[model samples]
Target chain A: MTQALVNGLTLGAVYALVALGYSMVYGILGMINFAHGEIYMLGAFHGILALAFAQHYLANFSPVVCLLGALVLAMLFCGGYGFTLERIAYRPLRHAPVLSPLISAIGMSFLLQNYVMVAQGSGIRGFPMEFGRRLTETRFSAFAGAEFSLLEVFILATSLLCMAGLHLYIYRSKMGKAMRATSQDRRMASLLGVDVDRVISATFIAGSALAAVAGVMVSMYVHAVKFNDGYIMGMKAFTAAVLGGIGNIPGAMLGGVLLGVVENIGIWFLGAGYKDAYSFIVLLLVLIVLPRGILGEQVSDKV
Target chain B: MNITWRGFSGFVFVAALAFAAACGPKGGAGAIRLGVAGPMTGDQAAFGEEVLYGASLAAEEWNERGGVLGKRIKIVKRDDQAKPDQATQAAYELVSEGVAGVIGHFNSGCTIPASEVYHQNNVPMLTPSATNPDITDRKYANIFRVCGRDDDQGRTAAEYAVKTLKVKKVAVLHDRTPYGAGLTDQFKRNIEKSLGAKAIVYYDGFDDKEKFFDPYLQEIKKKDPDLLYFGGIYHQAGPLTVKARELGLRAAVMFGDGVINEQYIESAKEAAEGAYVTFGPDPEKIPAAKGFLEKYRKTYQKPAGAYSIYAYEAANILLASIARAKGTDGKAVSEEIRRSPHESSIGTIRFDGKGDIQGSYYVMWQVRNGKFAALQ
Candidate 1:
């Protein structure tokens, strides 16, 4: 059970990273960024691309350096993509009904998935293990006589660091404050001289960067990257975000980890097929019991 | 408004013409169209692609050989998306397109629904990988399978585990899907029947997206099962094996044919190194399969999966029967298929009254260095 918890935590951390993007976007724009998952998938593809390029051109570089380069490249590319997506798909629908942008986001998701499918034929791309090897080497034979891999440790630590940084940014930074304000009241934030457009765009970029990191981590951990990775991972992250609190940043983190842990436990108690349903059931139960979320502050509109 | 109505009618007429043109003849009077259905997209796309590729190759071969009864064999491919509703739709489309027979609906979930359509349409459908006993038990006159059933596979794996591995205790993990749970049930029954009073722990199927299985592993560890049997596909099996190994569990991991894909190897990495599985008749061992394999590699530049060979054999049988029937008529072809001794890849295939393959053929395989190798 402890091992499952660790596994769930590791998985939850990745989901949390991706969910942060969704939560952040929702916090600022009050819109679910369905394209977040695609952005995450692009991050993984970019990581694979960077790794391939590095192996060919920068052979002298260490695996860690190459991996770091890949991660950065992935984040930058996906961050840019997120910014572009906001400009093209969401900008025009800002004043429109909530369903408009949501549908546009769904369309964008399909477009991205199909684009990748056509560009890269339907073959499962294997992420090279050169970098993964460095991270997941057996550390020590301690718990249940199992040895932890460096990759697993890196995943947990990297997730925590990213979460901590995000927390700091949301609470401590100027743009983060603008984002929080925008989420709270878009018109008020605009009146307070917060660039609502810029803040929303920045939210996408930040969330996308985290998603990109999560994507790379997933590719490394899973070792198989495919076009549809986004759909499944995206759903899970969205679930995590909702489970925590749609607009609560820290709530998303908690929700992600909780969902991951619950899924693993469900798999332990139930079977593999029920895992997806198990997580969804938890989400449903949480929504029924704590509709405002674990940390979300319930708000009401003035009558 | 009149102009627009005329234009719309014209468009509909043109589309109808185009559709007919697409289904137009390649060879003389009697072209046999064999329908192939599987998930060309979604998670199970790889399996579908392999099945389609194998069926296409068979069609090409039959057409090259002066056609079936001097009639060209054409394959009509449809994507089921591994969904029952889609499978039924695809089957309906294929039947309407006047296909002589169908080669699949790969998953049993899809096969069951699609098979009903084929039965209602009086179109003979041979499944390559839909192994649920209920599929054949329905005794649909039009439905048949070229592959071994789960009952055979589960029993064989259990026998190997008990007699060869000599594992005193066993724990079975399955996905809750029909394929997963059904196979697990079969394995449990066989293990218990073979080794009575020998503690056999049966666990329900888990989720594929789970991050950890430590709780289950912990329980299994406590039970001290000598071997672990996973009745699930590669997606979950891969991680389960890896995590189990990581947690210092030394039990040998085993699964059914679902774990036979190349993706499983990539997913499990070192954890799946020594995992065992039961597969259908070995393709490499079959003499007729060598030619097909060479052609498949030459055309696609990749070795086909084991199930693909079954697909090829199924397509071959369908075409052969069509040739013997000498027409695309469904009932006539079904009669021919019922009577015919199929000689193709995987040896001479003969179906019993229930459309199950006559001979009992199943093989045990082990994951050695990330590839399934025939276990001696």
Candidate 2:
């Protein structure tokens, strides 16, 4: 029982990381960023590529330095990709019909997925064992015979740190206040001397970085990555955003953790066949009962 | 408007004629067209490519040896994308192209429906790897498979699990694919009948896209089954075993023929150390396959895939039958296929009433030294 909870948390943390991207974008733009999962996938690819390069070309460097370099590269690459995506795909269609941007986002998702599929053949690509294998082998037992692998520990701690950092940035930072204000009323914020376009771009950058981190963490945990994983996972994170009340930041985190736990628990009773369905089930129940989500109405109108 | 409509109708008639000319069969008079239909693209392309390689090799060998009955054998390849609808279309397109026979349609879910198209068109098909029992049970006169059915493999695995492994408790899991679920059902039935109801501690099927198996692993951990029978392809089975061992579960994993790919070893790594699988005779061990295997490695720069040798045998059967029949008539070639035994890499091949190979056998293989080694 304890182990299931830990596993749920480990999986949920990554979902939460990805969900924050969906939630933030929806908050500001009033539309889901369907391509966020592909950003996560691209981050994982960059992580592996950077690690491979370090392993081959920088043999004398310390492993810690190499890994940190890989993470930084992954985040920066994804941040740039996210910025480019918004400018080319979303920005042009911003004033167009609402459905146009939504469709554009979906198209962007497919474009990125196939781009990776072609660049890196559609086969499963493995993360270098320097971290994934070693961490999986390292286990920590804290309770009555309940054990957690080092990878799980890393994922949980890193997720908490990232989430905490994001929380502080959103609540205490000037840029975050500007973002919130713009999301609430773009014209009013523009009238008040806020750079609405700049704030939106910053939101994409931050959300994408968080997603990249989640991608690296998951690829490490699963020990492999594939091209088509983005759509399913993107949909799951979208579900997390919806379940927690779409466009609500804390709600995305809660929904992610809740969805993961509920899915695992549901598996314990109904078997693994329905693992992917649990998230949608939670989404439907939430939509039916609490239409505004757990924390939705609190900030739905505000952002 | 009437004048414009009349002109448009005339243009449509000419365009229709041009389209038909473009789409018509393009086989040369001196070429004996043979179709190889499978997932030449999409996720299952790896398996399809294996069939293509083996078939091409056989065709090249035969063509060099004075072609089949003085006509150059030409292989027409089609990508089914692993969908039944696409597979049916490929089959019809091949038949219309005036091909002698086909060598594939790799998945059972695909081959089962596509068989009707071939049957309706009277085109003979030799499937290298679709293993559903119902495939042969359909009693199509023109359909034959070079691989063993799920029941043959499932019972073989169950018998080994019960008698050799000496496991008192068994858990069966599948990915809910036709092949996986079919194998699971057969494995569960055989286990119940052979080892009694107490042997089957658990049985269930999961979706193929599921990545995490901790919940299922935990549930199986609680059951404490000595053997976990998996009936899925390598992708899911590999990761599932990895997680099972990570959870410190001691049960040994056993699987069907679907776990033969190299990805299985890569995914599970050390966790795949002692996993067992049942499959048709190992191609590398066949005495007649040594030359083909060597040339395959040299040409492709990779080891021969699990089904490549079977594909060679299927191709040989089709080409040889076409030679003996002395025509591309489907009924005559299928008649020759059922009559005379053809000597090939996998040994003498003759079809029974159900169009199944008469003397095919299944064997057990174990993952030893990170590769499958035949088990005695």
Candidate 3:
């Protein structure tokens, strides 16, 4: 049970990173950004590429430096991808009927998935396990039956650090203030001299960057990435976002961790095969009983 | 437009037949084109490329030996993308293109549907990898597979667990794919036959897309099964073993041939050690495969994949059957294939009545020193 908690927390941190993207995008644009998962996938790919580059070009760098460098590079690339995706797929359909953007998001998701599949040969690309060798190999017991490792600690620490950084930026930064204003009332914020486009764009970039961190962390954990991996991860994270309250930022975080715990517990009690169904079950329950989501309904507008 | 279901299907079938007739292989002395279908562009392209290389190498060697019946062999490639619908389309396209036979389609899901098209068109289809028993159980005279069926491998694994390892209280899991589920089903059946119904403490399937297995491991640990048999491909198997070891689940990990690839080791790292998987004898180690391996390395400049030699042997047998039958006639060639004992790199090949290879080749392989070592 204790080990389940450790596993759930690590898994939840990754989900939270991704759920933040969906939450932020939906909060601002009223669009799901279905392609958000693909951004995460690309982040993994970019991080892998960055790792290869670092290993090849800067052979003397420590594993920590290499991992952090890859994370930063992946974040930057995914942020740019998110910005471009909004401009190409979302921005054009902004003024169209609501259905158009949703359709566009779905189409954009397919397009990005296929693009990666075509470019990368649809095979599971294995990450070299050499990085974080010590972290992964070194083990410590948290309790009698539960074991912990440095890699899991690193994953949790990075995720919490990113969350903290994001919180400060949103609550303290001027641009974040403009973003919150735009998300609350796009036309009103525009009328009040806020650049709606820039704020929305910034929202996408931030969400994508967070998801990129998650992508890198997951790649490190799983040691492989495939073209269609983003689809399921994306759906689960979306569920997390919706479960927490689609537009609620902290709700997304709570929902992510909760969903992860529920899924792990479900696997523990039921079986491993029903892991995905547990998340969707949560989605259905949240929809039926708590429609606005656990956090989405209770908290409003302060996304 | 006036249309009825029967009439529409009739017209479509007639048109397809006419098109096939129009483009069917001409009785000429140019080349014997064999359709090679697999996921050439999508995720399984690695295996697809192996299939292509294996068939092409066989074709090239046969051409050098003065060709089969004075005609050089030609390989017509098609990318199935590992999708069932696309595989049917590729089969149709191959039929219309007038290939003598097909040596391809890595996934059983793809192979099963594509076999129907081949059966309808009288095109001999030989799959190198697709190991699901249904591919052969349908009794399609035109369809055959080089690899052992799922039941054979699964039975081997079950017996190995019971007889050799003396394991009790086994837990079986699958990915719910045809290959994965079918293998586990067979294992369950055989295991029940040996140890009765109560032996399997847990039997279930999970989504292939699932990444986390901690909770499952934890729950399974409580069951305290002596063996955990995973009927899935390597990608999932790798992580399962890693997580099992992480959770301190001391149960012996066993898997199907799908987990025989090197990527399993790469993902599971040291955890792959002591893990057991069922597979045929390693073709790379056999002395009979030296020449073929040499040529394969020289031509492709890479190590042969799991199914490469199987594809090579399939191609060799198919062409030899054609030569012995003195034509590319489907029924005649298939009969010849069944009738003769052909010597090849994988060993002497003999087909049973249903076109399944005679006898079982499966043996338990344990991951030792980061490599699959056949257990003595």
| Highest DockQ model number | 3
Cα lDDT computed for each candidate against the true fold: 0.82, 0.85, 0.86
For model 1, how does the per-residue alpha-carbon lDDT over B1-376 read when each residue is reduced to its tens digit? 9999999999999999887777666442247678899988876678899999999988888767777777777778999987778988998999888888999989887898888888888999999998888889988777899988899988999999988999888988876667878898898999989887465864655644443465677678767788999887766677677667755678899998877888778767777798999987667877878988889999999998767888888888888777778777778888888787887767888888888998777778998876889875
Predicted complex 1: CAPRI docking category = acceptable
Alpha-carbon lDDT of model 1: 0.82
- Per-residue lDDT value at B10 in model 1: 100
In angstroms, what RMSD does candidate 1 have relative to the true structure?
3.9
Chain A accuracy as TM-score for every candidate: 0.96, 0.97, 0.96
Q: How many backbone clashes does candidate 1 have?
A: 12
Stretches of candidate 2 off by over 4 Å are A57-65, A140-146, A299-303, B1-32, B65-72, B81-100
What is candidate 3's lDDT per residue for A1-303, written digit by digit as tens? 787788888899889999999999888888789999999999999998889888888889898889888999999999999999999998988899989999998998999899988887666776656686777778787875777778889999999999888888888999989978887888999999999999999999999999999998898787678888898889889989999999888988998999888887777667676677888888898878888899777446544
lDDT of 3 by residue, B301-347 (tens): 98777778999999998999999989999988888877888898888
Using TM-score as the measure, name the better of candidate 1 and candidate 2.
2
Model 2: which residue pairs collide?
none
Off by over 4 Å in 3: A1-6, A49-66, A88-121, A127-154, A297-303, B1-32, B41-43, B63-72, B83-86, B162-169, B189-202, B223-226, B324-329
lDDT of 2 by residue, B31-117 (tens): 898899987765566788889998998898898997988888899998897777898888888888888899998988789888999
| 10 residues in a row with least lDDT, candidate 2 chain A | A125-134
